[model samples]
Target chain A: MKRIVQILDSYSYGDGMGNHAGALLNALKARGVDTQIYAKYVDPRLSHMGKNVAEYVPSQEDVILYHLGAGSELNRKVTEYPGRLIINYHNITPPEFFADYNPALEANCRAGYEDVKFLADKVEMAISVSAYNSSELARMGYTCPLHQAPIVMDFSDYTKAPDAATVEKYSDGVSNIVFVGRICPNKKHEDLMLDFYYYTKYFNPNSRLILVGNYRGFEGYYLKLKKYAKKLGLTNVVFTGHIKFSQILAYYHTADLFLCESEHEGFCIPLVEAMHFGVPIVAYDSSAIGETLGTGGVLLREKNPRLTASVMDQILRDESLRKTILEQQKENLKRFDSKAVADRYMEFLLGD
Target chain B: MNYETYAPVLEKAKAALAKKNIPETAVSFCDVRMPAWMGKAFWFVSGVKRKMKRRLGK
Candidate 1:
């Protein structure tokens, strides 16, 4: 049996990356490949045993699959290991994303760039999560054998709930707009909140906005956002904080409209989830959002909250339009289904 | 120094120092570019002072 070892920095319980890794491992196993996952930290919920590479010895038969993060020491070991190295570049943030254009982030990104260059020069192959990310690798001067295999989501556990509790909780006889993902500056949670507030005020007073996900390395920014919401007198805006995978589906199912204003993304998984639940989306026309949304969701050409509000207003005011978008989304989402993505990934991995 | 090779690191170091509120000139003088003799003398004096303080327990 072919042995594969996948390495990552951290695998939080029920995160997008963790879920994708789990599904990919299962698919590989189904193909009769023996797979083991190694990470600095693994979610306790996952069955795969975690091993700290610094303390553990890797077996000779193992093929190393690495997700190269910012300043990973594992880059050194990849050269030492006598196996095929496949690096999956998730999202390499450009220097502009930082608040003050943090140099540390830039240095780390440069290190990642060098690692990719080294891997491209020496390793077997490299994979990126999106065409945008692949282009980023090219920009970094990596001319390796690159393939675009976007992350896959498993919707088996995301069946629509029977109860209307989520709808009543968020909507309350109003339009409920939901935004999911980490509460960071790049995710633009504050912009979405401001737009939602204006959207509710000028367009639909009964509308409510729900923001989900945890604040990671952006607590001060999140606090500032909360203050901004309060300053705007947004009583209808609700911050659900961090939620579990099951709870996420509940929100997605109940939301009248899903909004994403992320300035960067490798592949927007929540956008796919929203479509799976037949939720119409309004998102910024940037990064992989436009690629993923295609014709299924409305895109804002500019980053103005009033313009975003106007777009949301249009979606809310027109029922037939919303239904049409949702129907198109259902069809558009099939291209990103786990089976199709998995097949493409395997084909790329095995070079078929 | 070639800007392509050294510019990025120097720029990053400058930014890091600025974040800490240390004067760029002072950091460059003390941290990045100090004469070998001056660095050795400073280290030797500091080492001797640390030893004396520890011995005296003061």
Candidate 2:
């Protein structure tokens, strides 16, 4: 009998990678596959979900699927396993983005490339979350079989009722423009702030921009953004730094527009969430944004704050246009139907 | 709808841009670096933790 094990550095609580890993674990188990999660740092709350990698005993028939995103000692250990090994490559951010913001992560990401490139020849198969990441793997010389699948997610979780208090507090009828992502340099938070500035200065004064994400490792960058917002003399810009899942649900529930200006994304999951909530999206066309959006929202060819603000305004004021975008988003979202994605992942995971 | 359909909206935005004052949007970060000794100490502690975990069979 063979077993499949998913290995990662950290199995966190609610971040994109953690959620995808957790969902993939359950999806595999549901299909009666003997699957387990092994990680270096397991969140205390999710300790039952996985065990420490130090205790992961290797078997000759075991298929090890290593999730590679950052530089970690675990990345080196997985290469020594004498069995079928797969590299599930989640794109790593370029180290240049973090040179000034975080020295530790910058070093980790720099070494991460070396780690990834070193494993290129060791793995029997490589899988990525998007075509963008697949192309990146190819560029890095991953010649083994390569497959692309959206991160496994149970979208039904989004249907859970948002916190009532949160929804009520933020649903004061004022327009709310929202962007949900980690407060990292690559996310281009300043660009979102500028669009909000132009929108408020010219179009609607009753609007507020909500940025919801954790800024623990990148405190310097977070502080700089706050200082920059003050320098712009911007008002009504809310930074909800790492809130509860229900509160995130509430924010998405109250959002009138989902705007993203991220320069790089393995696959922007928030775009799909915004579509799930029927919030029209306006994102810059870059990296995997276009592929993930799939005609679901308005894609800007360039990062022009004034133009983005106008497009946002038009989508907000023109009821017909907003309806059309929402309809397209609903159709586009079907591509991520949980069962379809899970089956696709199974084919890749269980294939020859 | 294709991106070109938003051309009129872009034109409107361009017209509006000509009338309003735009702020400089470039951002700069604070120069924050940890001393080499502290970094080495942190790495030493992490390596110890990994060794301890392995020894404890966890």
Candidate 3:
């Protein structure tokens, strides 16, 4: 059997990209390939699942799959590994996005650009999660065998019934509009507020706009959002900061729509999740989001709160229209299904 | 007046992250909390070894 090892910069328990890597590990093991994960950082409790990058030993016959989304020593090590290297390219957010607020982030992102290019010539083959990301590698002059596959999605969690307490907490009769993302600058929470303001004023006054995400690192931005919401004189707009998984499911079930205004997204897992939960997605047509939704969900090229509200009104009131969008969503979801995506992944990783 | 006119929360996070003592090699976008010197040392050695390997062509 061929041996394959995947390396990443870090692994978080519940993160999208991390989960993608984890799913690959499980899929590879199921295929009977000797596979393991190595990372620069890992949760202590989950140490058995992976090892530190520094501890990894290279093998000439072994294929190493590296997930590249940030700058790290792992880049230098993987570049020098002198073995079969396949890079799972996830686009690095442009450095300019963080220019005003954090120079360190700017520097790190800049490093990611340099590292990706520096290691490009070393890769035997390249796979990106999206065609948009593949195009980026092409622009960087990577002349290797390149293919695109959506990340393997685990839909099991979404299928399970959510926590009763959480479902009860959100069972209020209010119409809910939800967006799940980290409380960060790139997500454009301010725009969410603008849309919510118009959504409530014009379409459904009984509705509540619920923003569900972790507010740990970006408390400053979190505070600004609160101040902005208050400034808008908006009522019933809830920022449910860092809640439990059951709570998240409750939000998804209670939500009538999933709205996003993210300026940049590599794969936008939330868009797919919203589709999975039967929540119709309305998103800005930028980055990989348009590619992700295809023709299933609504894509707005521009953000107009008044017009956005009208569109939401149309979807909510028109049961047929909602059903049509949901049907298309189910069609698009077939692309990201675990079995199909995993088979594609194995094909790329093992194919000659 | 609208989202266009309002200052973004991302900027706030960015500014705050820039102030923290994080090494550039941090894996996460802005929530890096590792000691400064350790991250620096790892990169420093990695860079040196990379150059040496290239020179040796091994």
Candidate 4:
């Protein structure tokens, strides 16, 4: 019997890709598949979840699933290995998004695209998390077998008790608007602030926008957004820069509405997260937001600030409407149920 | 569920916008620059660490 193994460039706790890989590993193990995860870079916190990719000696019959997100030497070296190779294509950001922010990131993204193209014909199959990404694989000339599945998410993780201090701090009867994602250029945090400016100024003065994510490498963009908020005189806008998972859950718990104006997303995990938490979503329709959000919440066709604010105001003020949206989001979340998704992965990979 | 459902609400918002007078604030795009002070040291160290990690294939 051939063993199944997963490989990626980096594995860090709280990262969406790393979490997805971890969940997939657990799911495979539950099905009794002999598996392990190998990563070129493993965060010290998640050291147990992955082994050094260099230590992974591949045998001829083993099936290797390469989780491709960025450009790395690991991506290139894996092509020479003797095994059944498959590409788990997590769409990479276009280098242009980083061209004005970080040159190194721009180069990595450019190289990521090059690596994808390089492995196009080498892999036996390509699995993408969204149709938008699948189209990119097709455009990249992947003639091999292609399948689409939602990223494996362990929704039960949200059910864990959140930080008591976080819940006590933010749950003060004030309306809280939340968006959770890394503070990266592609996320378009400025658009979020603009819409939020309209919301707080005209709709409700007691509201605050809570942006919970890490801003380590993207501090320049973070600083610009902070300055922009100050110039607009937007008060009560909070930037919780990379806190604990419990603290994140607390934000979700206290949130009244989840608003996302991100311009690009491979598959917006936060939207599903908002659904799991029963927070109504109001996201701009771009990339995979529509498909991921489904009929769970309202989708904006464009980023008209006044219009966006109006939708948020309506959702917040109308209890019945809020209830209806939450119900729909709950229904939509059934698609991402951990067991169902794991079963789907098994079928997609093993042809059951 | 659709845009038409919010037509009445949006119309009211548009009216409120016309009556309320506030100067439009602009938040222009500014390119990111390198960090300063201790931040600069942290950035340099992380950059070097990433490069070393890639080279070591670990």
Candidate maximizing DockQ: 4
* lDDT against true structure, model 1: 0.70
Model 4 TM-score, 2 decimals: 0.90
Query: In lDDT terms, how accurate is model 2?
Result: 0.86
How would you class the docking of model 4?
acceptable
User: A175-292 in candidate 1: lDDT tens per residue?
Assistant: 8889988776678776787677667766688888889787544444555666677666778887876555656777876788999989988788888888888888888878877777
Residue A150 local lDDT, model 1 = 76
Worst 10 residues of 1 chain A by lDDT: A94-103
Off by over 4 Å in 2: B1-58
Cα lDDT tens digits, model 4, A116-216, are: 99988899988898888999999999999898888999887888999999899988999999999998889999888888898898779999999999877
Residue-by-residue lDDT tens digits, candidate 3, A299-343 = 776766555666676677778878978998888888788988988
lDDT string for model 2 (A1-352, tens) is: 4688999999999878888889988898999999999999999888888999889999878888899889999888898887789988888999999886678899999999999899889999988888999999999999999998888877878988898997998899889999999989999998899888879878888999999998766666676677777877787999998688989999999999999999989899999999999999999988888889987898889988877887888889989989988998999899888788989878887876
The C-alpha TM-scores of every prediction are 0.79, 0.89, 0.84, 0.90
TM-score of chain A of each: 0.90, 0.98, 0.96, 0.98
Model 1: CAPRI class: incorrect
In candidate 3, what are the lDDT values of residues B1-58, reduced to their tens digit?
A: 1122112322332344345432322122233233445434544665687689869995
> Which regions of candidate 1 deviate over 4 angstroms?
A49-61, A99-114, A160-168, B1-58
Worst 10 residues of 2 chain B by lDDT: B27-36
What's the TM for model 3? 0.84
